[model samples]
Target: MIDQELTKIKSSTVLVTGGAGFIGSNLCENLLNNNISVVCLDNFSTGKLKNIQPFLNNSKFTLIEGDIRNLEDCHKACENVDYVLHEAALGSVPRSINDPITTNDVNVSGFLNMLVAARDAKVKRFVYAASSSTYGDHEALPKVEDVIGKPLSPYAITKYVNELYADIFQKTYGLDTIGLRYFNVFGKRQDPDGAYAAVIPLFVKQFLNHESPIINGDGSYSRDFTYIDNVIQMNILAITTTNEAALNTVYNVAYGDRTTLLELATLLKKHLVSLDESIANIEIKHRENRAGDIPHSLASIGKAKKLLKYNPQFNISDGIKEAVNWYSKNL
Candidate 1:
């Protein structure tokens, strides 16, 4: 279905910000596979060159080595682009807590610059990477788009602010926009070597190295862990959907389920042990819970299903198996 939609816009060009990062790089690869031209904008920062190396030589792929924090860079990348997938931003709640100024500068200021450039360029639509962090302290069992809570961290504030700015852009400037609130997305090419590394990749790397992965709490905390393919689908749907009611709204991009941290660790061990039986000996450790971390997260993907026809193909177990296989071969 998505392939058919892409065929209709194969002649179009897309500008993907932070296109060297995990999610952004995947988006570029999928778009290029569909024969769509892509302009990738990245300053490296947290994004790695290796992620985009495969696409660098493709004729349809163009790399714009620049920062989104600069309006000129944003404008340069937006030039003649038919659509914009704004994935550039400083991620991680702890990183934001440590340096709120930089987080605000890139996530907030940089986002604004992209909006202005997209509006000025008169792009068809602007689909961006919003975050489940926007749900913040809501305490809802299954998070909905309309009911949001106060942001618990600087990172959450930045993502929530994105939705606010996007709304204003649609109403005030007549630019079409869609915000996808991603929930703990993980998969191939995800970095597992950083201080702010996501849990799944981090644990997989640690187990492969015979190191203990320390859980922040009792391992009871859970999350709606989504796969990268599902996220890619949402972005494509947001860009392709001609439904007027779907525009200028936010949708939770998740698997519509939740998994406990302990369950996640156990599953990782089970899958990795299959690759190398010796990994079964690696112990899982526990530590105090990290500050500003949510206890549980689940998303109501009903809106995405009803509006954009989002049907997530990967569940947690299937996603973990694939992720473990990738780490074994690549890492």
Candidate 2:
């Protein structure tokens, strides 16, 4: 945060929707640390209560056990809030492929509900969690915000719809909004157990238990594995920016680099070996690639740097080390 804007942010009461999830809980922790009042809303469908349990006693923190799919719940959560950080959504491409209807209901319809609530509440800005999956089938090396391809999965479609709705909400309802298209975000508090668990944490969990992490392809597919701290900075910049040009737009939150699946597994094992020497001898395994997964994904963070002054501090290796350390004790 900029020194001048610190006071305004500290005094503001922000609503974090999905505040019990990995990314949302981290956002809550950072905001509370900065002396900001936070109102968290969640249905506990995907978000875990243990993620936000530590903050339950904080005087500045308020928890609303509600679902965004319900309009009344959205409206009620938006009450007395200065800004809305919309992080609630049904994530995972496979999950969406298995249940597209439920995904659309929560990701698209529920997003619309939150947009309506934030608009009516006259919140200063609505900063939301967009996804790199929105890049879709675009076969570009470095994905930019403007150059998007046709969505390959139901989850990608829902996230793209969010951008469309966010744009319309800005034009129609005069609600200032920012959409953060996050890449593969990983770090502390990220759950490693679930049917649709993210790759990094899931691999960490498997390696911790000396189990093989199945890589879909020949371990060649790569991603711009972003650290959670960088994502938090992007959101903070979105809500705290004073520049008019920075408003009503989307930004790619990533490390501006790429790491192949084999490379990622290697890095994880190297770091994890420090905790357990036997992990160094564990064999990394691979399998057939999943459908609709692109070969590689990298982001051009130039727009964020120029507009939001975003400077990501962690790279893939550093992020892996940090994440490995966390999983060593917490997982």
What C-alpha RMSD separates each model from the true structure?
0.7, 1.1
What lDDT is reached at residue 214 by model 1? Answer: 94
Pull out the clashing pairs in model 2: 216-288, 216-289
Candidate 2's displacement at residue 203, Å, is 0.8
TM-score of 1: 0.99
* TM-score: model 2 vs. ground truth: 0.98
* Candidate 2 weakest ten by summed lDDT: 1-10
The sequence of per-residue lDDT tens digits that candidate 2 reaches over residues 48-157 is 99999999999999999999999999999999899999999999999999999999999999999999999889999999999999989899779989999999999999
Q: Model 2, residue 129: displacement in angstroms?
A: 0.6
- Which segments of model 1 are wrong by more than 4 Å? none
